[model samples]
Target chain A: MAGDAGSIPELDQKKYDADEQVKIICLGDSAVGKSKLMERFLMDEYRPQQLSTYALTLYKHTATVGNKTVAVDFWDTAGQERFQSMHPSYYHKAHACIMVFDVQRKITYKNLANWYKELREYRPEVPCCVVANKIDADLKVTQRSFNFGKKQGLPFYFVSAADGTNVVKMFREMIKRAVDYKQNPGDFMDEVMQELENFDLEKKEDNSEADEDGLKAESPDLV
Target chain B: MSFEAKRCGVQFSPPSIVLIYEHKETKTIRKRIIPVRNFSKYSDYSMAAERLKNHPRHRDYLEGVSQSQLEKLHIILRDHMQGFSLERSLASFNLDPDEDLNKLDDEELARKKGQMDELFEKNRRHKDDPDFVYDLEMDFSKTTQEKCSWDEESDDGF
Candidate 1:
């Protein structure tokens, strides 16, 4: 419902035909409300005391953009570090990611850098969004230097998971970006397994080539 | 009958054979166990044993199966307290413990960076809106499964 465009009353079945599928992963520390955020965005419901995702939970939604429909695959990853080992499986298929943090807890915001650092080790250039959750509480304003907007160099949305504000707009933008990426042949995936297999090897070659290219290349292989 | 598992500082009790397997690289072997209830004893034992034998990593570790080993295994399965021990699963890749994982050309790394950029952009646009708020809405009524038939085939959070 978050990505829904209008309230015309009549359902447009034709728009659903041009759907492009995208996978978005919600990742962060335990008890950060990744699942709840997702539920709020997709279903517009809230559960205060829900169990953290033990493995991975998949949620599907279809958003109509103009004449095309976008199918979103939201993969919720478990927050614990022990469970972090399973991240590769989920990230392996992810097209984009939403790293969530709790605004009330400074430590949660501090860990955003680490999450970014870890995610940089793998994936291609996929769009990311940061969420500062739990705005319903009074702001202590201490140690608030962790700017959600400036540090990540990405889109950021502050929302109250409890009160339901700005959550829909945030997800709508995500779906739009996902849909844009999907329209490009280079991004939408079908034989991703094969591509992943050769990806590391390709990076190794590119890295060595970058050294020889001597920064003249438009984008140096970061690896 | 009792089945219990103790490892990594936590204990779990399942009503069937407790197969405690460890993985090292391609090799995987059942190293320890605490069997509590064995409704289908032979099938459970055979399945566990077969998993060990067929595991890609631990095939060499099986070696010869002596009569004494079989007796020990049976005793461990029959008795509630007696069980086996196994080493923790080890990764084959010799990665430095302190080495930053960002050096790896894994796909997750790239996606995260992009996600960060997107978050920054979103925040810049809506950081000060007074009406900004989070939403929590779900259709929990859609779930219709009233009965659960737990199956051994279901992976244990693999």
Candidate 2:
């Protein structure tokens, strides 16, 4: 393990059993504090997730859902900001989604529709959470209601990664919902995904290696 | 299930490559704003273009688009991010080779240099070409009365 990875905790080797692997993807415009939220949730302090070797880091967060530890892969594709419509693979088989927007930037909040629209295009039924980030910048805004999440009937959160307010609560609830979806999907989307992959595409498969290979093959653009 | 590329454009506010296409199955017109990540004013337009074209997930959707077309959009995005006006950037399309590149700002000069490099690559002849000759030579007509600063011969400079 690298020195920096130590400061960021890892699942205990002795008890690490990824019986249920869940992928939680974060979607937002450029500089919307998506990484900051993930960093804050993973570690005590918010440290910008680095991509020195593996492009963007997929945080392996170990969470307990119903007494069974579930290994969750937190997706924060930092430089993957090329399109308002994200790559479908970004939502491919994703269990849950975190849609974030910078509270200070109104445009980011306005663009949530495009992000959510694209999210539904691929994964129509995944549990999604809408986050109003950077509350520390102006805590007063939290008192106001953002109707995007309410209209869509998705869970909405007011989080501040900087001062660490409501970050834990938001992530914990997201994990629980994702695990619930995995155990008992509300509709046929899960079955369709399984049919498409033709595999269980479930807990036993360790996606770390598969994803690492994918990143390794991704060369510097224009090369 | 398939998308046909109708047109492509650049979005400056968020630095995105907007692709307008029609869903072949649904017959719906859709816009996919592909976000340009980790890009800056100093980012290489061609490289950025290639990166977007070859992005692991994005490449599949961008397959129908042309590389040159994508490069042009990236150039425009880079120019806008560098604070160049739309007119000024568009004006580069019809570059006057005789224009004084020295008078241009650093960003403009760099862009012009990039254009020159691309042009040079297009016209460059290699030894393996059909017209390749080992003893290729040409004679140039001398200027009438031009005496540029570099023309002066002095012992001080090599």
Each candidate structure's count of clashing pairs? 49, 11
Tens digits of per-residue lDDT for model 1, B1-158 = 02121211112244222334444554544444333333233444334545544556544433233222322343333333333331211121222323333233322322232223223323322323476443433322234233212212332110
Evaluate candidate 1 and give its CAPRI docking class based on DockQ: incorrect
TM-score of structure candidate 1: 0.43
Provide the TM-score of chain B versus the true chain B for each model in turn: 0.21, 0.59
The docking quality of candidate 2, as DockQ, is: 0.01
Q: What's the TM-score of every candidate structure?
A: 0.43, 0.45
lDDT of 2 by residue, A1-223 (tens): 1112112233222222234788788888665667656766776333444553333446777788888988787777645543344443455557789999877666666667767766654554568888887766665676566666554567777776655667778898899888877666645355335432532223222332332233224321211
The complex in candidate 1 yields a DockQ of: 0.04
Residue-level lDDT tens digits of model 1 in A5-101:
2122332323322547677777676545676577667653332222244345667787787787667767775333333333333544345778887
Name the TM-score of candidate 2: 0.45
Q: Tens-digit lDDT track for model 2 on B84-113?
A: 899888787554534433355434544554
Model 1 chain A scores worst on lDDT over the 10 consecutive residues at A1-10
